[model samples]
Target chain A: MGEFELIRRFFDRGDRAADGVVKGIGDDCAVLAPTPGWQWLVSTDMLVEGRHFLSTVDPERLGHKALAVNLSDLAACGARPRAFFLALALPRADAKFLEGFARGLFALADAHGIALAGGDTTAGPLNVCITVMGEAPQGQVLLRSGARAGDELWVSGTLGDARLALEVFRGTHSLPGDQFVQVRRAMELPQPRLALGQALRGIASSAIDVSDGLGGDLGHVLKASGVGAEVYFNALPRSAILAGQDLMLQQQCLLAGGDDYELVFTAAPEHHEAVKDAGARTGTRVTRVGRIRTEPGLDVLDSDGAPMAVLLASFDHFKS
Target chain B: MGEFELIRRFFDRGDRAADGVVKGIGDDCAVLAPTPGWQWLVSTDMLVEGRHFLSTVDPERLGHKALAVNLSDLAACGARPRAFFLALALPRADAKFLEGFARGLFALADAHGIALAGGDTTAGPLNVCITVMGEAPQGQVLLRSGARAGDELWVSGTLGDARLALEVFRGTHSLPGDQFVQVRRAMELPQPRLALGQALRGIASSAIDVSDGLGGDLGHVLKASGVGAEVYFNALPRSAILAGQDLMLQQQCLLAGGDDYELVFTAAPEHHEAVKDAGARTGTRVTRVGRIRTEPGLDVLDSDGAPMAVLLASFDHFKS
Candidate 1:
């Protein structure tokens, strides 16, 4: 099939009319009408086969993960998902592959009310690059630079499960069949905490998505905000499987393991209750794992409050 | 180097701030403030190594072509370039390649006054995907569906040079060193008709970019506008090199050669003088090559006004 035909059959969602879109697909450009009182938030992510995903991954989950990762960026900014542009490169227009991919992608997109505004398709090695556009009310958008010293550091949902799943895939660790399926799902199909992110807009002082491990991703917020952090290492929430692992393994996965698409945020101590309420309302589990500091370095504290000298490096695409 | 360091050294443009950009790089998502009286126009394009370009292409020229092709889509919509997000996947972090690529990319970006608001970079096969956001005054954006019967078809700049250059590279044709360089430049460094496109905003009834050959691209406008066209085949503007080629080669290049990056538009015959003024004001050479028709098929006519039997197919990414 031709490029246009491939797009029409798989990616086009013209039947589902979306609000704020002046013009959608089949045009040179997708035109959108921005809400009057909101600011546009844009983020992009590129996924390559055998680099970002395993060659054995199901096309459906791959599609979901591709868009989910971009949405995670929007979620970090406490922005509501609006629209996205997809640029896809495929070895060929395999009908079954496209069908499964679209099914997974649109399922998540429809859940978030994000429309497929426009895209380009071509023949090449498989690659999916998505640019997601979202919007946040003026002055309410969460930014990493907004954190202040003494703010309480918090995280949504559990951490390190995705990393545990990756370890299993690499044969560094093994799990029972049932548990393997569960953690593998965490690695393959991450949920972008949109509702929780939006809920934390006014409450959270700063926020970031935990895609590159808690320690490394939190370092970004510290650098941008010009503050340090004191993370209670033992306070980090993890799955039962990870908790059963050895202390060192648990520490490594909890601190430096990546691909956990959860929000790492900060809020003032006085608004602790408000933060908890926001999380409760959004149906997301909130855990206070650290606190911002005026000092210029991170300090991970053990359960007994002693500083731990953990040296697990975060996942770096090139260095890894 | 790590991904963050790579971005900081090469792609980050935090120094040169552009209007409407609330946040540029070093963030989860770039925030943009949309103009109140304008609408957002977004387009995306992906160029993969060995598919859209040769393996031996200059990094600088490839970068320029990457952004230029995306901007061409914005130009087709008569939108003013504003901000762009780039997602690049490279085989490795080659500093020299990045420096040259950034030089060409930033030069064009500076010329168009478009800002590099955000992007993602990863280690993988070479792929450059850019999503450009532009803006057009309310109700003034040109669209392919706006063409009507009796509207005069027009085009900006020359056609077929890029295709001729491709033919020479493919060993199907040959040119002198000096002339080859000229056509090669056309193929590699296409200039987007931004000025002419914006100038034709109110005057042109419909517009489209000639990326996938004149015949194929025009077919899109015809399909969208529910109108056909009678193209004056002899009147198609061409470079001296292309004009020197045989009639059959000329027909193939002019009709089905892609990657021209010129604007093909239609204006009411009553606004013919206004259209000419738009081109002159923008310093773009405009050619009156055809007229829109109520008939539902494109008809290419010879100098004697007789229909020609041209059967060249447009460039398709998959089929080609």
Candidate 2:
């Protein structure tokens, strides 16, 4: 089939009324009629083979992670996803690959009620680039620069499992087959905390997605808000698989290893109850692991309340 | 420099107030406040190293064309450029390359008043994907499904020069030094018909950008509008460089050779004067090339009005 025909058969969802998308695929440009008082939130993420994902990953799971990562950006901004565009470059028109990719893509899109608005498909090496558009009330959009001193730092869902899966995949560490199931799933099919993020709109003074580990991602909020933070190492939330590992490995994955799609946010101490309520309503586990401070550096405090410094760097594509 | 630091130092424009952009760059998601009553237009295009462009291309021109092609889609829909997101997967962080790329990117961005929003930068094979957003008045956006049976087909600017340059690059044909210069420019730095497209908004019945050849692109308008076309070979406007070529070569280049970022639209006979006036106001060269028909297929007519048959075909990445 032709590329255009391939697009219609695989990517076009046909109905977009549920999401307020006036036009979808097959047009020169997609038209969106956004909520009048809401501001538009837009973010783009590109995933490359070998760099972002292993070549052995299932096409279905790869598709899910590609869109899910972009959705996480919207979640960090406390925006409701309205639609997305997928620009894919594939080596060839492999039917099995296309079918699996499409299934995984629409599954997540359906859950969020996000329409596939428009995109381009071409022949090249495997690459997936997604641009997601969302909406939030004009003045109520959560921002990274909203944090202040004395605010409680919080993270939703578990951390470190995705990194554990990566280390195992890279042969740097080994986990029992049964123990790796959940970790592998964490690395492959992460769920964007859309509900909890939206609920934290008024509660979160600052927010960011933990894609590059909690400490590094939270660093963005601190730098933008002109504040510092104190992360209690013992307070970090980790899965059974991660917690069972050695403390050193746990610290490495929790603080610096990337691919965590959880949300890390800050709220005033007075809003602690509301933050927990938001997480509860969404059925997402939320934990208070740190505190925003007026000081200028990030301090990782030991369980005994003493500063313990070690190398924990964020994933920087250029530098690393 | 790290990816984040490189982004701040090079890509971030610092001031986005002029475009009504509430937030940009450093944020997880960029916030946009579009014109209140207008509908938003969005289009995405991906360029791979050896597919859409050659590796030997100048970084500056490649940067401009990457964004320009997407702008061309917005132009086809008669939308005014507002902003765009860049998702780049670079092979490495080369300071010289980044400097030239950013300079070219910002140059076109500044001219069109389009702000750079949030994007992802990663290390991988050379690939550039751009998603551009624009705005058009409600009920006035040009669509491919609006053409009537009896309408004049019009194209803005000249055609076939880009294809000639490609042929030269492939060693299939050669041009004089001066001729090659202009043809190479056409292939490298195409000027999106922003002003002309907006001018034709009310005058044209249907429109599309000629990226995949005029015949193929107009076929989209035909299929969408349920009409046919009669392209007059003698009537197609050509650049001075193209006109000096052999007749058979000229026919092939003008019909099926792609990469021409020109606008093609159809208008009723009664609106001819208005179309001319619009072109004059925008300082764009426009020509009438054919007429829409009630028949079932595109008919290419020879110089003397006889049915012309040739091996002209549109560029399909998969089939090619």
| Residue runs of model 1 more than 4 Å from their true location after superposition | none
Residues A66-96 of candidate 2 have per-residue lDDT tens digits of 9999999999999999989999998998889
Model 2 C-alpha lDDT per residue in residues B39-74, reported as the tens digit of each score: 999999999988888899999998899998999999
Writing each residue's lDDT as its tens digit, candidate 1 over A126-179 gives: 999999999999999999998999999999999988888888999998999999
Q: Compose the digit string of candidate 1's lDDT tens values, residues B1-320.
A: 78888888988868337988889988899999999989999999999988889999999998899999999999999999999988999889899999989988999999999999999888888999999999999899999999999999998999999999999999999999999999999999999999999999889999999999999999999999999899999999999989999999999999999899999999999999999999899999999999999999999999999999996589888997
- The candidate that wins on lDDT is 1
lDDT of 2: 0.90
TM-score of chain B of 1: 0.98
Against the true two-chain complex, what DockQ does each candidate achieve? 0.90, 0.85
What overall lDDT goes with each candidate model? 0.92, 0.90
